[model samples]
Target: MQPAFTRERVGVHAADMVHGITAVTDAWQPGRTVDVSAAMQSVTARVTARTLFSTSIGDQDVTDIQHCLVVLFSGVYRRMTAPLGLWEKLPTPGNRRFRAAHDRLRGLIHRIVRTHRRTADAHDDLLTALAAAHGDGPGDSLSDRELCDQVMTLLVAGTEPTGHALAWAVHLIATHPEVEARLHAETDRVLAGRRLPELADLPRLEYTGRVFTEVLRLYPPGWMFTRTTTCETELAGRALPRGADVLYSPYALHRDPRLFAEPGIFDPDRWHPDRARSVPRGAFIPFGAGNRKCIGEHFGTVEALLALSTLCARWRLRPVPGAEVRPRPETTLGTGPLPMLAHPRAPG
Candidate 1:
């Protein structure tokens, strides 16, 4: 799975991201209000489907997936916040809905895996790579069930968080004219009148990259995660027994004044190479740390950089007047129903 998301492999999927962003931008009309969150989610979902399965999933399928995710994640949040796990065992309405959504999503993934296995070598995508991978031991080979589980994990991880982070970037750009101006300038200079950005142009879009890094720092999609101690450990002079469940919030860590100057400000320059190194290790863990770090980190970053550059190049999305735009922290920190009007940018 890690090999499937290496920088070189991820670069092969750049065209998929370009196509997805084009589809979204093509549907946008001047002054038409678009749900930025939903639109970003649709773009990422399409891109992930193509890159992961070597097939295009219909708009309706994306919608169905999103609906199931919403139901399932809300249930997870409930279980996480509750004091005891006993309620989860009960067949309550919430629990029932969660189980149904889980089954529905799993069934879809299983069908996809079965279909892909028939023509495994015909396609060049993540599924094919995983299917062909082998190791020394027989147990190293993935069973159908294991493959389905891996795909489900990648689908959820690759789609929702990246989409939500892009939505936050769009919102931040809309509200902060200074930041938006800088972003547009960088894209215009790098793209030089091109309608779409290519993987080669990533190096020149440095500011665009910083903007996204800042976006992640401010509004990381995986807002909170829980880790269990494998062995007894001590933290901040407190002793912890093995198997202790410790919950931490990247959302809170990113806002600490000690790690970042004026932490609440939407300043991209803070991510500049010189300043970026000033932040201590373990202070920035938007994608977790150690072996548990996200497998798709580089892939997600490329998708975001390309998508943001593509959108910023052709149009500016402005929050609709009087619309309330705020973070809605669920499974991911998403901006729920973010209505923004697309204004075409004047030619460079």
Candidate 2:
């Protein structure tokens, strides 16, 4: 059976407010998101690094891991549509890149594992925890190959949607100032000038949380999610054949008027408690549902909330010169090749 979708504590989100941005703002604060994509990469890189490598893999290693992610992300669509035989030509450029990236990622993880053995200190990083076998052994412990697979899974999943989600959160909040104002109000009211928001503060950021929920409604990072049916079943009384590919898209579903009132508009109020509490479990499924739901939902939202509050606290984004916020409906939802104008506002 597939695992259930539950919230996860993404390593990068909580930590980046300290490690990545503070450094940038103190020393390298540019007035624009000139390298927003690169920033996304940096954030995801740190998350993956901290999660798996802990003490062993450094910034350069993170870059290589990001490269593998790019290789796989760039080719995922091609693989989905390419003919099996043509796709299997192992020497294809993208496949070759994937192979190289996969190797580098695995090598980095192994090196980290070796280093953890030498230290033998009770380290808290995910990889060190995995390396030492935290719970049980063999029957319960992960093999080296499983270790590699988990690392690969984390690298691919930990980075991509999150990176994209971070980028979109910036774009969405920047473009919608009313929404931005409300967002600030909620954060300011709930956070109450407290020491930076933490896991504990998450529940208090309800409206800010809905800002993410609404953003997910408009341009969810995981726009098109899929699953293969295992047994014959009926959804809305429509017969679904077993083994058939079931493509249930949050993007399409969220826009279906039958599922949402005025389904075409972007309104955070729609997610207000009374309304949100009433939403059918599957009506808006950006993170997906059932056993295969997103494991990092909590972590991703927390990361976004923290980062958005921090950035909005500092800068106001205006459309940049020669740039517009355009949606690219790639496998994941994202802004176009061109980023939006996001000139930081003077702090009030």
Candidate 3:
């Protein structure tokens, strides 16, 4: 999986990303207010589908998957944070909904995996790779059940966080005139005479990359994660027994003034090489750390940078006046409803 997401391999999906972004942006008429959050989610879902399965999912399937993911993630968060562990055992409406969503998503993945197994050679995506994988020993190769599990994890993790991060980047750029101006200038300059950005163009979009890095820092979709101790350990003069669950938040850690100057400010320049080095290694963990780090980190970043560059190249999205844009933290940090108006930009 890690090999599939390396920089060189992820570049193969750039065309899928460009297509999704174009479809979404094409529907935006001048001055028409659109829900940026929903739009970005739709784009990411389609892109993920094409990149992972080498097929286009119908609009209905996309909507169903999005709804099921929301229900499943929100339910899990509630269960994890509930004061009493017994609460989840009850047959409440929430639990019932969670079960239904879980069943539906699982069934979808199983069907897809079965279908891919039958025609694996026809596709050239992640699903095909998993289906054709071989190992030296018995049981080393993934079984159908394991394939379904991996597919589900990749589908859910790939779609939600990347979608939310793009939405947040759009919101931030819209709200900040200076940032918006700089972004437009860079996109216009780098993508000269081009309507869409390509993998070869990413290296020149330095500011756009920094903007994405800052977006992740400001609103990492996986805002909080928990880890359990494998053995007894001590931290900061406190002793922890084995199996103790410890939770850390990238959202809080990213905003620590001691680690970042003017932590509340949305300055992409903070990622400048010299300035970035001042922050300790472990202080920045938008994609987690160690062996548990996300496998799709590079893939997601490339998708985001391309999407941002393509968008800024042709249009400028401005937040609707008086529209209250607020963060909704669930399984992922999401913008609930970001209404914005798109204005076309003259070609550079």
Candidate 4:
């Protein structure tokens, strides 16, 4: 189900994504500080909405869904760190708000599902594909509730991490002029006055790709993940009990000095082909590893690359002076309100 749609149908949505991000960036006036972090979220959300559910960014339904998502995730950190887990069920103000948000979000998703079932056609979106899959077979098909779950999962998962990654990428590019210059050089040379990037241009946009790779390495949205041992095992000559939960943090591993030289610095050239292969195994798992890895990985990568290429080709985003930039690690690792000034780049 994932491969058939994510790999094959992504191109159909790529053009729309490019247009969406381009419009967002084009609206920015020179020398004005724009909250790129917010813009990135809006852009990714819109792209994922249109591609996954055929929902328009401007629609009130989309706005409500987005707002509900914000409220739903607002308490994630508290939920994660809560000792007894009683806070979640209690009708405190925060919990009440979360419950309300979750209900609204579910209602929106279910409404969209019903609309799709009633009005869907040969449209090339994930919802359409899932609906068709459910209608195709007997026992193997997903139930309506399952369909809603998948839709919600895709919208939430596909939007947030990609949005944060793009936000970090913009922040990195704005702060590092040398990296930014090289990125522009590659894009300008490859684009050659072309307005939008094609899939083929991805290979030649080496520097831009490396920039994104480094960005993910430094600021992976999925910073840490957990694994459980099904059977008792030994690691590094130490015994481990079955059902033991092991936590691995990619954020820490990526920045380990033992693994990467000068790990704290933002260096896109570290990903140059020759040097990139020298990294040790299990040192980098941004999206994740094994079968549970993110299904939207490729789609997100393509979307981010296109966004960086298309926007950086025309405008240079500079971080607003004295703006406090820091990671707001919650359910997902994110940057809070990255303010940046946009300047139009001279045509090459």
Candidate 5:
């Protein structure tokens, strides 16, 4: 529960999709880039199961976990948005399902923990990391409940954003053939068809990262971060009031004409650190900058880059016929129909 979602899990988590891509690619044998949404799903499921439970799960378990996530998120939103006088005694079927999801997730994780402890070969995956990371910090580890809660958090947080980001990246790359072509060229130049893109390949993937940055800007997975005022302070010269709820909207910030030369255009080069330096601190926050920013930013970024680069290293995505990619705003803005198709990239 107390395990800090660190950079380490990305490698283990990546193994899931790398396998999925190989399986999918071999089946289609496409010569151009193959859209790897199915592969992305595999990675997302793997991250949730492996990161939280420190175990592997089947396709059905992954599907069940996603269903649980939907319920849990909906329940949270309902509780937050419910009327003040609503009775707690009344629980709907949906709430029941939600709680069941929560319970199932908890039960599954603890069983995995117990199983791992019993086994001699408990490998150094996230569960192993959590087992080793026992004390809260130095001498403190999480309690069983805390571990379950943290695992639950990872199940939801680890999946939704990365999944949506993958979808967005695919849609963006698919529709913009020029951008897609550039990405294909970039991955080829950087990796030269080495088995898969590794953490080592990330530094060489500057523009690939920018594609993610720009995509995050235009379609941020964590679209709006909200906070209630614990202490009053001025923001943008506005007088602050205590207890005021505020939202930081990256969508608005990313598209502001004053900050971007052409906000609507898909331009990864704009994120070149030299050019990026000019944007105001709060204005450029795709992952939210500074202390209170998301813990998963770097982790998620790396995961997305690896997934995108790995998939692009082999397959191409193009628009699906009659499919409209419209933004459905919820916790994250998901593009509906995910309007894309995958084809294999011919070797350069």
Candidate 6:
């Protein structure tokens, strides 16, 4: 999974990212507020599907997948917070809907895998790797069910979090015009007049990178994650029995004044070269830590940076007046239909 998202592989999807961003910008009109959340999701989903499968899925297929994702995400938080998984089996309307959503997504992925096995070509994509794994033979081979699970995991994990991150980046950039100015200046200097941002240009666009890092610090999509003790252990002064579940909130830790100065503020300059290294080791985990970290960290980073530079260079997205734009935490801390007015800028 990790290898499939190497810089080389992920860079192959750069053209698709450019086209997706262009599609959104082409539809933008002055003073016409659009749902930035949905727009970002559409772009991220197209990028994910094209990069993951490298196949052309019809518009209806894309729509169906998006619908299934919404249904699945809506009930996941409740199911997780419910005691003993009791609510999951109640067969209420929501529960049934969730079950149907899960089944539909799973079945769709299974069919995708089977179709890939039959005719999918040798492409540098996640599906190809999974297909190879499934054909490893005998005890080493992944079952069809296991392959479907992997596909579902990658699809859900890859799409929503990256989409939300980009959406939040746009929102933050819009609200902070000073930072936005710096980002635009950096993009203009680094990219010159390129149609799309390249993988090699990432380092030169330092301010853009800092802006994204700040966004992650303030609103990490994986706001809360859980870990379990492998065996009986003691931490600080507490005793933890084996198999105990511990929850860590990046949302809370990122805002701890002890770790960050004026923690509530959104200051991208805090991530400057000299200042960034002074923070504590575990205090800045946007993508997570250790071996269990997200496999798509590099992939998502490249995607967000490219989208940010590409779009920020041409247009500014401002939040609509009187719109309710607040964090709605679920599987990921996300917002709903963030209405933003897009204003075009002169080309560099």
Best by TM-score: 6
- Would you list the C-alpha lDDT of every candidate in the order shown? 0.87, 0.66, 0.86, 0.83, 0.70, 0.82
Q: Candidate 1: list runs displaced more than 4 Å.
A: 56-101, 133-140
Residues 1-348 of candidate 2 have per-residue lDDT tens digits of: 012112433533366534544433334344544546556655766665665565566777766666667767777767667787587467877688767766776787777666676775756566655655645554777667777777777767767777777777767676688888877776667657653556556677777777777888877888887788889988877998998787767888888887778876768789887887867778887778877787767666666677666655555555566675666777677674434444544333
Q: How many backbone clashes does every candidate have?
A: 0, 4, 0, 0, 20, 0
Write the residue-wise lDDT of candidate 4 on 209-241 in tens digits: 899999999999999889899999997798999
Residue 156 in model 4: lDDT: 80
- Name model 3 segments beyond 4 Å from true: 56-64, 83-100, 134-136
Per-residue accuracy of model 6 over 239-261 as CA lDDT, tens digit each? 99999999899999999999999
Instruction: List residue ranges in candidate 5 displaced over 4 A.
Output: 1-17, 20-41, 53-64, 70-97, 117-121, 128-141, 236-238
* Model 6 regions lying over 4 Å from their true place: 90-93, 134-139
- Higher lDDT: candidate 2 or 4? 4
The estimated TM-scores of all candidates read 0.90, 0.83, 0.91, 0.92, 0.81, 0.92
Mind giving the per-residue lDDT tens digits that candidate 5 earns over 241-292?
9999888888888899998889999888888989998877678776777777
Error of 5 at 155 (Å): 1.5
Taking all chains together, the TM-score of candidate 3 against the true structure is 0.91
Better of 2 and 6 by TM-score: 6
Clashes of 5: 20
Q: Superposing all C-alpha atoms, what RMSD in Å does each candidate have to the true structure? A: 2.5, 3.8, 2.3, 2.4, 4.0, 2.2
Task: List the pairs of residues colliding in candidate 4.
Answer: none
Model 1: how far residue 325 lies from native, Å: 2.3
